[model samples]
Target: MAGGLVKYRHLSRDSAHRQALLRNLVTSLVKHESIHTTWPKAKEAQRLAEKLITLAKRNNETSRRRATGILYTPHDLLPKLFGELRKRYLERPGGYTRVLRTEPKSTYDQGASAILEFVDGPKDLRFAMTAAAVARDRALGRKSNELTLKNRSKVLRYRDNGEKAFDDMVKRIGKLDLAGVNKGGADKSGEAVA
Candidate 1:
């Protein structure tokens, strides 16, 4: 009820989910200087990444605090943000990042995906990859094959007693191959293959 008028991508997730997405994307962008994600996600992360870069440019206590609240770990994030990235882009007057579309689209959702990278940065990524890939690439000073799961479930759901019986029945039926195997009985088709 508080923000009923507000508008944002639902992404089939609740408020907390959206916020977490933003935080992770921004963090990745800072650490990697580039990231690949769905088109919509890239667009949304661009807004936040630019703002964070602007804060890095400011390089003040208050700005650092604001960034840390969103970024987590002021010591780690703020230093690199205000130090290296800030120095690199200090002369630029905004438009800090660019989103380039990945040809052939994405395999996951079949929606357009993009690589969002800092201006005057690397531009020849062969595939659209997750932010974790970008981070690993940075750490290794070259691309790495490592992958990290982003959306891990925080809640566990258990079936009730009634549901458990149906689940068990389905599992048993799944293993009962319907053809090309003997079940200690004749074919129920009332016929045989020659």
Candidate 2:
């Protein structure tokens, strides 16, 4: 007897329905780098997309096979995703996607609507970490002025000369002694400092 048994099912049960959903979701994600959807589907797709990215990160034959199996996409596209895209995100440890809510269409479905998207690369991580550090410092009642100044200079340098410039700025800032500076331009040694 099938007593107390329950069969699990999906919202889109048919093959055509499922395939359409997957294709459209994947295409939208690739083209726009984000998409808005119902909370349940968005969460599921986010898991799938991250898995694909992890496969891409591996960049090997096995990973290619795995991605092909999971995504059911053309093998040719794997190289671009795994080679160029993977390299771009090499330094990031995960949480590559972000979800931000938007206004709902109806009160009945007024659950959290959100946009899920990829965060470009490790550069975003640096910016996020810097922001977090500044916030933490402020919360702890410690001086974050030095970090703020250093991050400002780094941002300016990056805007001027790109990632290499930012790297150089970080190195230079790391070597500095920041205790001497006050709210004014004068150093502890009573000298005008840049």
Candidate 3:
């Protein structure tokens, strides 16, 4: 009865399972701005994530609700996705996410691993936290600052893994020369006095 109508990958899972898998993958990708997954899965998740990001670019009540529906994670990333993430990608026409291939865990699996990440999403702990902060304010609809182990551990891991890179960069460059920063010598207070 069915013919030529199959448009999406099944991921070797039943309907419900596949839907859940894609949802979780996309959720993680959006929340953390990166996710390590197998090639096929990464591609599928990227498709969905890209669609959602385009939707986010609309930056409206409908888009927010729709993205919230698709990325229905407990942490409620809709606000951040619609606000910060949307703003970041507004100027770009498309290609919101990138897929970077990495070595597979083993040759037997014959599956390549890839990292799916947002093009301009946060790459450091401080900004990552800040990106999610404004959304958190509206996402939770409350004043409580409590968090779950999964989220707490996620942020902790981000901080942990990012520290090495931060330290290495500081050692390599002494300090980053952000644009608009004064190239002149610093004053006695070690501030850019121009």
My TM-score estimates for the predictions, one after another, are 0.56, 0.51, 0.59
| TM-score of model 1 vs. true structure | 0.56
lDDT of 3 by residue, 125-156 (tens): 33343335423443334442555324434334
> Number of clashes in every candidate structure?
0, 0, 0
Model 3 residue 14 distance off true place after TM-score fit, in angstroms? 1.5
lDDT of each: 0.63, 0.60, 0.67
What value does the lDDT take at residue 101 in candidate 1?
Answer: 85
Clashing pairs in 1: none
Write the number of the candidate with greater TM-score, choosing between 1 and 2.
Answer: 1
lDDT of 1 by residue, 4-27 (tens): 764557666788888789889888
Expressed as tens digits, the lDDT of each residue in 1-194 for candidate 2 is 65566342244557677656755565566545668876656666676678778888877889888767654454655666777668756766777666655677468968767666766533434444455555445434487777675864543432323456444544444334344544455776888877
Locate the minimum summed-lDDT window of 10 residues in model 1. Answer: 151-160
